[model samples]
Target: MLESLNESKKLLPERVAEQIISLIADRELKAGDKLPNEFDMAQQLSVGRGTIREAVKILVSRNILEIRRGCGTFVCEKPGVVDDPLGFAFVKDKKRLGLDLCEVRMIIEPEIAALAAERATSEEIEELQRIEDEVKELCDKEEPHMHKDIEFHEMLAKMSKNMIMPNIIPVIQTGISLFINITDYSLTKETVRTHQMIVDAIRERCPQAAKDAMIEHLASNQDKIERLSGL
Candidate 1:
């Protein structure tokens, strides 16, 4: 039912935690799922209850588990990484934060678009087209579609086929989206036009054009933010 850790390892508690994570994955244990008690886990893993307790403590610290005083330990709603991994809370200047996010996108997205142009499969390009179409539809209706807007960018990062880029894109975009959604930065004819250019460049397999379009797109966004803030 659960994985057993190697007894030979000196770091029993850590190994126990790893084994618990393996169990969660293997059993498809989702958020709010109850883990077995310390006694049962100890028996299953051939470790002392104390080791199990230590492992549970570690999992709690990592937000993988939560303790209810009377009910016992359960999984957290969303686990693994915290919501704001970049410490955006500590940043006092919202305008500066928005500018910084734009700078990061300018650096990261152009290369991502170029890589995606080179490596993207037919299915990936088709997905990008679908996203672009949705963005156009929302823009036509004059609707706020920040989620769709971010989705298109995230999909581009995924098309790059680089594991790290996909992860980094979400974190940066979350922060950027906070500012864009709060202001009038997300919904506009220029946004749809620029994003369409990026998608078209990628679909045509023009890596240089894709990169240029992506840079131009983010630069447009930065310019809009600066104009609105007069900064």
Candidate 2:
């Protein structure tokens, strides 16, 4: 059930949106769960149907909810997580941005690999191996493999079993895209080899080895960036 809003509040739509969000939290609505219809929702919140519509629109824009043509509005798979949360697209110098992202990854990702090695389930390890193989196959064929590369890193983050790890995936994804574009996929062999090494270490459940492999992998990328940037 939703709480009735104070009529005197300015920006009633915004206030109603807050109440709806609170109701979502209070009700423990999972992703893909549909909300009550507009009329019912308005009745429950003691607001006008038009107000509820405005509030829902706001939530949809924030990536908290999505509207289906036939189906009702439902929670988004990754609530509150936007595609470009860091506004990386607005940055003019992608080479510089890629280098900065690599620095950040070097700081955080090795530890994430270690955690993944320690925490990954058997199924997760198998999935990681599959992704690694996919990347290798793509590289051997000289096909586009950037998406698989991104998937591999995202899989490692998930295998870390840290709730917050997955949330940082947009950053990792953007960094990988930038790196691939800037480097022109020049490190195909290195990419295949390091991905194999990282997955092998994780499969063996060797935390230190995984961490070391991840460091080597990222270091290779960083080295390439430095060379290209004349740093």
Candidate 3:
């Protein structure tokens, strides 16, 4: 009977582990809170130690737990999603307000462009050109070019081939688009010129040149936003 019940689809080990994590979260378990030993926890939850171990491993990898060499596991001193060096917490909760998200992008996108300039491949450069061309074509069409514009920046970040970069790129783009859409500002001729400068720097493999171009592009964008919204 126990085995049959344990095999139920809804009561899987992962679910049980999630429940434990939720409990700790709800109870506001501080760092150094000692979780019950596997044996006792298994008996109490009617699940095996393996489930708890797997759950602990997930949290550990996410920096929520720290398994000591000889001592039992404990919550990390700062347990949360690891922040990228660039302060990348833009898309964590889907409920984040749009303006708050844009503020995050106002900080990150320029740097991503600079990195892409330093490391993008020929094929990636071609892709960015294609994205730019597609946007030009779309501008003449009935619909907006917002998605394509976002894709362009995202592709530029992917060109960098940095491990965590691709992940942060979309979050930044989403925020940028939030403001862009509200303001209805497609890439103007001047914006394209700035991007072209960055593209040229990338083609020449000049990291500093790319970085400066990106900074200028973003600064000009800020000026445009003020002109559009007076914010």
Identify the leading candidate in terms of lDDT.
2
Give one digit per residue, the lDDT tens place, for model 2 in 24-136.
89889989999888998899888889999999999999899899988899999988887778888788877788778888899889999999999999999999999999998
Q: Provide the TM-score for each candidate, comma-separated.
A: 0.75, 0.91, 0.54
If the candidates were sorted by their lDDT against the true structure, best first, what order would they fall in? Answer: 2, 1, 3
**Which ranges of candidate 2 are over 4 A from the true structure?**
7-10, 175-180
Q: What lDDT, from 0 to 1, does candidate 2 have? A: 0.86
| Candidate 1 wrongly placed segments (more than 4 Å) | 1-39, 44-79, 180-187
* Overall lDDT per candidate, in order of appearance: 0.85, 0.86, 0.66
Q: How many backbone clashes does candidate 1 have?
A: 0
Report the Cα lDDT for candidate 3.
0.66
**Alpha carbon lDDT at 48, candidate 1:** 94
Better of 2 and 3 by TM-score: 2
Tens-place lDDT digits, model 3, residues 111-210: 7777887778898888788887777666656357667767777787787777666677665565445434344445465566777777778888887887
RMSD of each: 4.8, 2.0, 12.5
